[model samples]
Target: MPGETAPVGLTLALGRLRALGAKGLRVALPIAGHPLGLSGPPEFNARALDAGEAVIVTGVALGLVPEVFQAGPEGDVHSEVVWRSVPVREAPPADVPSLGEAERELAEALREATEVLSRLNVAGAGPAAQAALEAYRARAGRGREVLAPGYPPRALRVLELAQRVGALIEIAHGAGAGAGEHGAAVSASEIAARAEALRPVERTARRAQVAAYNAYVEELERGGS
Candidate 1:
């Protein structure tokens, strides 16, 4: 393995720490590597940090460094472990919230946004709809345009649909191993697999939600007439 050293390589490091009288110290391991040159150290460190566990990341020069800091609260040391990185060639999405509990949150955001929109008020609904639509698009593999500008009211409608189905799919996809223990930030491959597993449920939910919303709106408009 290009990045995987013998367990002894790391075990010796731990032994050094112990010999140095390091106590209550937590050690993280980079379990795997990818063909893209990315490694698992960062994710491992993130899990450790999230658990409020104290860690001193080592193993740089082997493409693993802990220079990056994901700052913590007062008196707590915070940092990021980078096993590998590529320079940004393009801007990433504005945000990517967790899709683990996304469906439940999406459902709530949609309902609240819908209620606001139904009352012909859209100010607070923007943020709400944005959250729901983003979660939906994440699972459905659609882009962020589902929550784009120039369509605040319609975006709320779209959000409602996404919430109903996006959450269903999110829940249907079981948690990956170590997900709970790792604070839900696992390896890239694990995250990708979880998202892929959600696609079908998300798609089905999307279609049903759209059709149902359109029908209900049409009926509402007819009643108003």
Candidate 2:
């Protein structure tokens, strides 16, 4: 809104959303071959893919993906963020796994990924990267709400599993790619295989994340919390 002709205001944005007869927001995480939660007009899908995320307003044909602009010199740089709304189609939500199913799938994925890494002899990262990974795990383990209050607790569990899966993906990619200074690169064959194996898990992680983010809206649509 700040970049618009009328200038910025949250009220203006809310009013526009209300005028659209909005029901709730649905999250989209799109990637090639997998439009995770998007059912779209190509324009909206393309923008969301570029942004790597979007929010579609259910019960209406509209979506918003944010873009940030930065300018000015280093010491006094300026930046602005805008949610660029795009036209979308109102379609049935993408079929995503339930929390229980996600958890089970994530668990199996974790096991398979671990075995793959271990078999390929790329399971452990360099000391520094290992420490960083441990720190991240500790942070994730802290009791906290993964989403806003309106979302059910199961969403939190799914989010946590998704994050764990993401961590595994990172570890696989990092170890395979020789990320840290002290890290040794795995064989090209292993790297290729690792990537091939983790692709589905990575997609699952994205799907789970979108599901968790949109869970609140799903609940609202069903007339429940």
The alpha-carbon deviation from the true structure for residue 147 of candidate 2, after best TM-score superposition, in angstroms, is: 1.0
Off by over 4 Å in 1: 1-164, 168-185, 217-225
Local distance difference test, per candidate? 0.37, 0.73
Per-residue alpha-carbon lDDT of model 1 for 101-212, expressed as tens digits?
Answer: 3344455544543443333322233433445445655766643344324333543455555655544343323212133421132356654654554544444344333333
lDDT of 2 at 18: 76
What TM-score would every model get versus the actual structure?
0.21, 0.85
Report residue 135 deviation for candidate 1 (angstroms): 15
Q: Which candidate number has the best lDDT?
A: 2
TM-score of 2: 0.85
Q: Candidate 2 on 16-68: residue-level lDDT in tens?
A: 67776877878888777777777788888899889888888876678888888
